[model samples]
Target: MTTHTPYGDDPSQYAELTLPDGAPRGVAVLVHGGFWKPEHDIEHAQPLVPSLVEAGWATWAIEYRRGTGAADTLADVRAAIAACPVEHPVRVAIGHSAGGHLAAWAATQQVGLTHVVSQAGVLDLRAAHDAGLGGGAVARFLGHPPGEADAGVDPIRQVPLAVPLWCVHGRADDVVPLAQSQAYVAAATAAGGAAELIEVAGDHFDVIDPASEAWARVLGLIEQLGRPAG
Candidate 1:
C-alpha cells in the first residue's frame, strides 16, 4: 500500500511513499514536471511508483509548490529530501522535465543523496529562459530573466556535481530540446564530475511513462545508481 506524508503545512508539500513487499534495494525520490505549474501535480507521476516498488525500491513521489515561484518549489524539494530516513540502504532521485531541473539542483546542495537522474530535465535555466520554453515558464519560476537569476540554482552554472549523475533524454522530445541534457552533461564532465547522457528514441513524456521503452532505459539507469561503488 502507498502512504501520503506531508513534509510541510502546504497541501503541495507532501510525498507519496510506495513501500516494497520485502527488503528494498534502495529508495527512489520521484519528482514530476508540469512546467512548474499548479495544474501539474504529483498525480502525473503516480503511475511510475508501482514499477519502482515492484523493482524492490521504496519510492517517494514528491509534490512541491509550483507556479508560485522557484523559491517555494525548491524549498519543498529540499524539505522532502531531508525528510527521507537516513537508514535507507541507498537514496536516489529521479525527476522529469521541471522536476528534472529540481533533481539536479538538489544533488548540488550536498543533501546526502546517493545519485541523481534527470529524465528530460531542464538543466540550463539561462538557455531555457532564452528559448522561452513553456511560455516563459523559467521567468515565472525564477521571478527574473535567466541573466538576473541566482547562479547557485542554475544547474549548468553550478558544475562538478557532488553525487553521481545520469541524464536520460528522448531524441524526439520537441518540448524540451535534447540540447538541454547535452549541454549540462558536457559542462558537468568538463568540470571533472561523473555524469553521462543517455539518448533514446521517444518523446518528452515517454521517459516518464512506466510502460514505455524510454522508461525501461530509465529503470536501467536507476539500477546502476543503486549499485555499490567499487
Candidate 2:
C-alpha cells in the first residue's frame, strides 16, 4: 500500500510513499515532469513506484505546485525532499522532463542527495527558450528569458554539480531534444563534475514508463549509483 504525506498546506505539496516488501536498500525520490504544468501530477509516476519497491527500494513520488513559477516549484521539491526519511543510507532523485530539470537543480542544493537522474530533462533553459520548447514554457516558468541570470535554477548554467549526475535521454525524444542532455553532460564533465549521458532508443515518455527498456536502464543506473565505492 502507498501512503500520501502532505509537505505543505497546498494540495499539490504532497508526496506518495511506497515501501518495499522487505527492508529497503535505499530511497528513490521520483519527480514527475509535464513541462512544469498542473496537468502532470504525481500520478503519472505511480506506475514506477511498484518497480522501485520490488527492487528493494522505498519510493517517494512527489507532487509540487506547477505553472506558478520556478521558485515555487523548486521550493516544493526542496520541501518534499526534506520530508523524506533521512535514515536511508542511499538517496537518489529521479525526474523526467521538467522534473529532470528540478532533480538536477536539487542536486546543487545541500540536500544530502547522493545521485540525480535526469530523464529527457530540459537542462538548458536558455537553449530551451530559444528552441521554443512547449511554446515558451521556459519563459513562463522563469518569468523572463534565459539571459536574465537565473543560473541558480538553470541546471546547464549551474554546471559541475557536487553530486553525481546521470542524464538519460531518448534519441527520438521530440518533446525535449537529445542535445539538452548531451550539452549539459559535456559541460558538467568539462567543469570537473561527475556526470554521464546515456542515449536510449525511445521518446520522452518512454524513459518514464516502468515497462520500457529505457526505464530498465534507468533502474540499472540507480543500482549502480547505490553501490559503495571500493
Candidate 3:
C-alpha cells in the first residue's frame, strides 16, 4: 500500500510514497499529466505505482499546483522534489505529457536527478504554441506567446541538461504527437546530451497503462537508467 504526505500546505502539494517488499534499488518520482490544469489531479498516476514498487523502486509520486502560473507550478514541482525522501541509491523522474515537460524542466534546473524520463511529453513549447496544443496551453503556462516567453521555460530549448533524458513517445498518439519527443531528442543529442528517443506503439495514455507494452518498455528503460548512485 502507498502512504501519502504533504510536501506543502496546499492540498494539491501532497505526494504518495510506496516502498517495495525488499530494499529498493532506486526511487522513481512519478509526475502526472493534465495539460497544466488544476482539474486533472494525481489520481491518474496511482495505477502505475504497483508496477514500479514491484520492480524494487520506492515510488514517490508528486502532486503539484497548476493553472495558477508558470512560476507557481514549477515552484511546487521543485519543492515537492526537494521534499522527496532520498533513501535509495538512484533517483529518476518519470512524467507523462505535461508532467514530462516539468520533469525535463526540473532536470535542466539542477534538481540533483540521475536521469529523466519524459513519457509523451510536451517538450517544445514554441512548437506547441505554434501548433496550439492543449488549446493554447503554452500561452496559458507562460502567460504570453512563445516569442515573448523566456527560453528557460521550454524543455526542447534547454538542451544538454546535466542529466540525461529518455523521451518515450507513443507513435500513434494524436494528443502530443511523436514529433515532440523526436524533435527534443534530436536537438539534445545534437547539443551533446545523452537524450534518446524511444517510439512505442500506442496512444498517449498507453505509456502510463500498466498492462500496455509501452508501460513495460518504460519500466525497462527506467531499469537501464538506474546506474550506480551518481
TM-score to true structure, per model: 0.95, 0.96, 0.95
lDDT string for model 2 (67-141, tens) is: 899889999999898898635768899999999999999887777788899999989999999999999999899
TM-score of 2: 0.96
Predicted candidate 1 versus true structure: per-residue lDDT over 42-79, tens digit per residue: 88789999888888788889999988888898988999
| Model 3 lDDT tens row, 1-230 | 68898988887898999988767778898999988988887887899999988888888999988889999899998988878876555789999999999999888665667789999999999898888889998889888887734788888888888888999999999999899999999999999999999999999999999999999998888887553343
lDDT of 1: 0.87
lDDT: which candidate is best?
2
Which candidate, 2 or 3, has the higher lDDT? 2
Better of 1 and 2 by TM-score: 2
**Judged by lDDT against the true structure, how good is candidate 3?**
0.88
What overall lDDT goes with each candidate model? 0.87, 0.88, 0.88
Off by over 4 Å in 3: 227-230
Against the true structure, candidate 3 reaches a TM-score of: 0.95
lDDT value, candidate 2, whole model: 0.88
